[model samples]
Target: SQGEGPDPYDEILQAFKIMDTEENGFLTLADLKQICESVNLNFSNKIIQEMIEEADNTGDGKISLTEFTSIMCQTGRFKYCAPK
Candidate 1:
């Protein structure tokens, strides 16, 4: 997969899979927090909650693959979101 060139989306999805260790098609707030920590993103709990609110369009308080992908693809990065 080394020569595939610029597969940031794929990389992000793979990370999503790894983070979603429960494999339940969604991530709890706790799970998201752990992921942020594992990647050394260093976000506060409030920031994580804000991200969840922005991505969890269904108001279920969990992030599904669709929602995660939407956010990741939209931002095209994983360093957290802020108004550009």
Candidate 2:
């Protein structure tokens, strides 16, 4: 039963994958904007840019999987945290 259940981490990975439409191993502003539109979030560019800035530890103007996971693990109900 343990192995049969879907892992929570898998869901996060899927979400990141969906956001990275170009499969470039990173989430760009355009990619995030498209995802927001698809989900009907209606977030303006300013807000979305701010969101990107908040999570972009590397200051590369894009979110790598590692950066995304760090934010996800830091907030919400996830108990794990990315290693420093």
The top-ranked prediction according to lDDT is 2
lDDT (tens digit, per residue) of candidate 1 on 3-84: 8576556677787898897888887778888888888898998998998999998999999988887778687465333244
Superposed Cα deviation of residue 67, candidate 2 (Å): 0.6
TM-score, predicted candidate 1 vs. hidden true structure? 0.68
Model number with the top TM-score: 2
Q: Which portions of model 1 show Cα errors greater than 4 Å? A: 1-12, 77-84
* Model 1 poorest 10 in a row by lDDT: 75-84
Candidate 2 Cα outliers beyond 4 Å, as residue runs = 1-4, 79-84
Candidate 2 TM-score versus the reference? 0.80
Residues 8-83, candidate 2: write the lDDT tens digits: 7777788889889999999988999999999899999999999999999999999999999888887775533434
Q: Per model, state how many residue pairs clash.
A: 0, 0
- Give the Å shift of residue 44 in candidate 1: 2.3
Global CA lDDT computed for model 2: 0.86
